[model samples]
Target: MPSPLTHDDPQAFGPYRPVARLGSGGMGTVYLARTAGGRTVALKTMHARIASDTAFRTRFRLETDAARVVGERYGAGVVDADPRAETPWFATEYVLGPPLDDAVELCGPLPEQSVRALGAALCGALGQLHASDVVHRDLKPSNVLLTAYGPKIIDFGIARAAGDDRLTRVGVAVGTPAFMSPEQASGQEHSAAGDVFALAGLLVFAATGRPPFGHGQAADLLYRVQYAEPDLTGVPSSLVPLLAQCLDKNPFRRPATDWLAAELHDGSGEFADHLPDAVLADIGRRAAEVWQIMPQRLLAPADEPDMAETVAPARWSRRRLLLTGGTATLAVAAAGTAGVWAWNERGGSGPDRPPAPGPSNRLLPRKRLDSIWQIQVDEDDLFEEVMQPGQLHVVGDMVVTVAPHLIGVTAKTGQRQWASNLMDSDWQVATDGERVLGLGPSDEGASSGKAGGDPLLVTSIDLLTGELNDPQVSLPEFNGELVGDQLVCTANGIAYVVAGRGKFVHSRFTANQTWYLFAVDLSTGKRLWTTPLPARRSGSVRLYFLSAAVVGRDLVALQEANDGTVHAVVRDTRSGAVRWDRPLAGVKASSVQLPLVTDARHLYLGAGELRALRLRDGRTAWESKSSRPGRTYGPPALKNGTLYAIEKGLGMVALDPGSGRVKWEEQGGQGVEADLKAVPVIGTDHAYSRRASKLWAIDLSSHAPTDSYRTTGNRFIAHEKSRTVISMGGNFLAAFPLR
Candidate 1:
């Protein structure tokens, strides 16, 4: 397939031919070519300048030989090559299809099955490469080609043979630092396990659509890959164990390639089945090791603070979750060996609607909340929602979310109400008991059709009809609160508003130049005085604005100063003057959110720790300190006077809010990090907890056996008046009636 180089120059040399362009990289270009005899081959040529150097040619020869020596497995096959050719060329089988990055971008991450297949193929390729004493210096998404046949590892230009002197030639580091194993990045020679580490990196890219180290320059990337653990939080639960093994920093700990291949091949049909036999063997082996080592190392030292103080102790609680308990259940035959099971019970609150007229106690693992069916509404390839404060706001039965666009979904069904197309608006929706208020597109130099100097556009729609009750209203300073019909807000440091409208709007801009909070007048475009508050440092000390809320007649604007104090200023809604300014001591806050709990006496806020504070005075009524061992990231849910807190790996903790007394706790599975996305939901007679990917319900006010609701996928807690619903994983939200 190659065309002869007929230029005939002495430097160029003979009838060298050009073949199909294979791929380009930082070092050189590769092509699929052939000799005059029609034997197919791959040819890689160095860029002109690098090709001219004798030292470069020698290194190229070593890389070519390493490629050929690594031979065929599931990857592209390296054939004969002329590393000594004038331009220094090597040949490999031409592979079809786009790079893995392109493939995922075009078609999304391969499903669990394909992901397992891809992993198996790459593991096989690496097994062969490692066996031949070669280290693929670069193993990134861009270098791995996803052919129709399977994934084929390619672009081994910088590959190095074990103990090859060519690897240290001149200044060539010989690997993409981001994908390089930590040991290799520390100036050590690549190990077989390092290739396993690189394969882990590729798997992470396949799962999250971004490298674990994120985008950065070579040095920063290498620094991160060396010291930081890849954020595998979003990875599918089934693949976590395999990836964790592959990413083991110590070479001895990494699973062998044979094991990896078997894991992939066996698990290719269903993610649940993909456990490499080696991984299972390793888990058992490690468990024994952990048991032996942990006893000597003091896993639970005698004098450690009592974890029981954080939550309840034993009745299905999170307090004891820190214990590295290894209990397993074998009830469901289909659940296989690994994976968590839903700890459920029966006989709780009746169904919210007509209690499903079915036989009771049927052992349906997936339970439908009375009148409520779960629906996993999230689309594939979607990024985690990252809206602050009001990201997840509920207005009647309609919940509006603004991660950038104004999206509305039915609170009961998870069905999309509507997704707006207006760009740069960044809409935020709030409600005034009757109508929905949208505040956005009214910032200075407004690009959207909302406004320019008075960038705040206020529209009020009936909460039930989703129809505009009041036409567009223009208000100046575009920030504030709604006390009944008064639209109070502030902009440019002065609080003002268009009064007696349908709703009040407020706009608060953060230091990052994005509006954190914006409220609009639901009735008339009247000029409202806007007050600007000092900005605060976020959790990472990033510049951001303090948030505000309208409680009764008080407009409380809370900010965390440069010093770690939560400054709360209560402004009068009628007048712009501050009623009281007090800093809550001992509360280190990045951002504080007060969930709209139905009681004015109880204030629910989230920061580094989830705390229940009294509204009358800045007094911590109760706090869930997740800083303890085993307690990861999760917020506590407060209902009535009881609080439900969860710890990673442990289960749920029920506490008495007023006394900070542990009432009950449950032993779930895994840690809080696994189920942080969902909060516990409580109804009149029952409580529901989401663990890992399952939902379970516990009955209260009963001395007999508890009622349990079971569900699949992820579960989220949604509250409505007297009814509570569980957003069961896989698009099912079930509502239970409180009776």
Candidate 2:
């Protein structure tokens, strides 16, 4: 409801004409104004005294930027602004509907669907701001407006970039106490996760008629927000767990915005459809009321020198957070007295945590629900204690993943064709572009102390059906119970594996173990070649190979010796004879976990600097020369005739394979945070890499990272046939667009 303007109110500001008073405060006044075209707007202005302060003017500019960061769809779109003016002002599209609190007061508690719709939309609005590293330090019911289009968030006057502390002061709490997150109430740096916690509180208020923490003096409210559990008595049963997780005390334990959005709704229908009929009617009535407002000034007595009235203005900004009560309120709360107030934003008991989690904090996903397709895996293995997690393989149009058991899914769609307990461990599977091969589920593969063992059984699977073909290979000499055995790789029509003949052990290598590297024909299950391998040290636990791949007529593998040193070993395909062996410099066997990157002419490897080794004689094809001392490169990835690798200080660098000359390095600082441990994935129009815990797309034409998507991927492989990028991490497997 708009009130008649006072005698001191200005008739007009620039082009907009003030029609009625909307609200007022110590810092600014909000008025109902109209442009020359008769379009209504909300005109907000800083007081002449406050505008004189340069710092306040700077914050006003930041507020305007933050509003634009949320964008027009989810927030009150900024129409115009002039922070440089003597009396700085900001104008925005006047939202037609009532504030959320007023709507709830008129329509009572919203039904479940309305609450879900509201929560999901708020998540999107907040997500937009969070994506740009901003946090709405003040998000409350009065800051939200309900419209026919959807809910709109406003009042970014206090918002700031995440991790920025230049404007905030110590010992002065800055948000509405009732709705503030625990960290915010404690004067800590409020992060995006804090916003999520506040969002859950808003949903709680919309579901019930009360705030999660019952209203009281600001002191008591802050205390409850910091130490007490949310009052979820009226929250729907289905949403209890989800909201509870969002309100978790530990910020790291709280769910992200995307996860909350997916859990609340599937984004099925129009937002208006979920609102109650009464609210819809109210939204309509308000639009009609905006045009009826007319300017009427309350004139003071003609000769009184225009003395101003001291009437308390409506609650609009931090004034809404004041604790009106007796002296010395609860704890060191931001209430009444000087000691209780907090003016700074320091997190934890000491220093503040990073706005985003650090690399060591791999306990949670940075974001969720951004994948093209995802499937929940319930991996249950017969030998659960002994079976290791498997790898992700793309063969033709299917993607095979294992979390102990093999699952075959269509590459384009995430539809599972078949799943079986046939595959036992990570090294039991191999692919040859057109065909998939793995060891059949044999109980004899489990770790045991029995002297004699069953024969190693081999099988091939149909790509479309996942059905095993008959005439499975069974070799008596190779014991199937040894956990260290590996089906390394496949090329042409032959499958290569390293098997041992000794007493079976799960994590230990016995002194009597005799290992053999051999190739078996998939069609006839006949042995093509066999060769002996060096014996392992007694009771050593390390496996023989870090990773292996087939290149032309040779089998190249990174083999770990008994001394725990990693060496590159290339063997002839015809007779399994060792062709060349060279020790890889400095790289640990554990750090080089991805498969060997090789092309027809050379094998690419390195961490400190990339080097291309000739396939013909393991001689150096070319080594990267560092332009600056101490600058280094991560592991290299090959695509088309170029090589991609992460160079420290610089981002993704492209090199010509033939001459080993620099082509172009990726532009933009986004790649400065690239995860060097994982391999860079090459797509059709963009090169993909893990940067800041998300899969970032580097535009090929501009040679700059253009966009990033939330992901939990540890390793990525692009499936060209399906136009999908397959990602695998922990027990999860997901996909994204290739280009």
Candidate 3:
């Protein structure tokens, strides 16, 4: 429903006048507006802060022009726009009917035939968009309007031209959580295929009255979209195969929009038959009402350009706005009452303003910075067995390095304590302080193409002796023929291996795939219990899996179904009995790759914000607000009752774990590219941060940079006990002493 415009809302935007407020989100507010010629439209304006961004404005202008050129047949036509305005505003043809979501809620799920028809129409729309070299990045139920003629896709705010740099800033997920495709969830570049995948998700929701993937926290929903299968329980069986193919995790496997249109286009009556008479009547009534108010023919003013003309050619003078101050002030006013205008106004001095000077490069005269050691480990040979650089773990006076093989080195002397070669190139290593567990595909089975080969093996090594002490466990279920496996270990001597079964046969579903979580004893290398994750009722071709974690004697598993709902279950470590099972509430789990971090007392999760949940009862302890709105937060590093997180826009922040209060923060400068995953490694008295090629050491006492060093690479691991900073540079690992 449209809401009444408040006093702060703009009365007029260029040639359009606001009538009512339509909707709002992180992007900006949308308003129901009308042109002077009596043409009703939806006018969307960027927040003042966004509008003030030169790059953002350039993108908005280019996208709006592309949207206009794409024409109005498949979408809400771009009728008018002013991208160069103080606050960029674009007017699209008013879609009179209720959104598909509202229609579904009001009239229940649509029949199968109607869903097919809806799919055909949306596919046709997508076909047009794709043909025009555009991708409707954000396509969801709310963006689809149930018009009398057909469904019209709306909201092209984030849409981009093909191969264009995505307008989404770093750390921000682009599309809606429930409807985004797997590639989108994984932060991969999106293409026309992404739109087709979203179309399938929308059709499933229309048929089943829920998102294809069950909904929950954004993080969980995103994880499911990226890794798990969709739940199509209530969907029509006849459409299962088509929808399954459409929702394929591999974008290349999904059919093109044109092919989908052909497959779904049975006849016009298919849609009419599935829609309820009441819904049809309501749609008809709304269309008639809209037509009554809409002008029979739109007439452009004498001085104003026609809608077909591009708006890019019309540019206002920047100096003129500065001199008059009217346009600048008006732009801020139109940014709405969200207070974003103040932020934009204060973002920098001006568009051409120079950046602030950086701190001096001189090293601090500290006592501990006397000696350094450089080790040129054979990276080529090591990586021949391990594709990526292995992780570095600090244990007591020894440093444990897992580069396929386990190696122990004395931290103080840089002497090799011991080395064990029991792991393979594909193995993943996890440590329980005293032992390191390696899990991966066995060499023979990995090289074999046969299905019956033994694929997975687990080995354990003692940290102190670096001795391979394992009753090697061979997992036939995760044979090399399957998808893959992941290993996660807790401090409590338990290791959980998530194994995927690829595609399997099921009585009800055709080509089904399942994932199982196996709990293994680090010492004995025996599987204590195996739990098969609950599968979504999607068709045989669908796949599902659970993301499991061990936190404080509790086994926590999070699974998301096709309908976009995430189920988090906490179970007793000993019995595997459910302790508490409920939906995790917070930001969507888009950062599925970031391993969940937990201390003794609470589990810390970071997506758009940082949230802490008590380990004992699974209750939220505290939630820390993001310093910058909509900016994604990196996984948090916790130590001594303090949590350190890196915000994409705000850089590094230190927070009090109990109260979630911000203790200190350091900005990474305006345009510096800091690795989100390279979390600041805290030492006894200093914290090290790596941004690109520079490693900065900040004194913990003053929370300010005390020294900076030029590094060959961006990855840094700190051994606080030895007061040393370890960094990787191609084939070499260098250790620098810190005071």
Best by TM-score: 2
Quote the lDDT for 250 in model 2.
Answer: 82
Summarize candidate 2's per-residue lDDT along 245-345 as a digit string, tens digits.
Answer: 98887889998887888788777666768888888788767765766787787887788666543222221110111111122112113211000011111
For each candidate, give its TM-score against the true structure. 0.40, 0.51, 0.42
Best by lDDT: 2
List candidate 2 segments past 4 Å from native.
1-367, 378-390, 440-451, 625-629
On a 0 to 1 TM-score scale, where does candidate 2 land against the true structure? 0.51
- In order, what lDDT does every prediction score? 0.49, 0.72, 0.62
On residues 1-739, what C-alpha lDDT tens digit does candidate 1 reach at each position? Answer: 1222222211211122343444555567664443443333345667656876766766676565455444433455543343434455555654434567876676565566556667776776676566445678788988886543345576666777554544474333458877888877877777778888989888888877777678889988888877887778778898988898888778789988778777655533332243333323433342233212210111234566423111111111010111112121111111101101111112222112211122211112222443444322221111111112223455576665442334455756545454433311234455543445654433233233221222345666554444444566644333222111122333322223322211222211123322222232333453343444444232222112244556665565555565756676556665555666677654444334333332455555543355665656546676656324324435567777887766555656666766556687564333343355466667776666665444556566541124444555343545564255634334233444333
Q: How high a TM-score does candidate 3 get?
A: 0.42
Counting clashing residue pairs in each candidate, in order, gives 61, 11, 25
The digit string of per-residue lDDT tens for model 3 on 369-479 reads 223654333222212111224456667776666532356676776655554434423356666555677776564533342333346677776666665566776666665
Cα RMSD for predicted model 1 = 24.7
List the candidates ranked by TM-score, beginning with the highest: 2, 3, 1
Alpha-carbon deviation at 468 in model 2, angstroms: 2.3
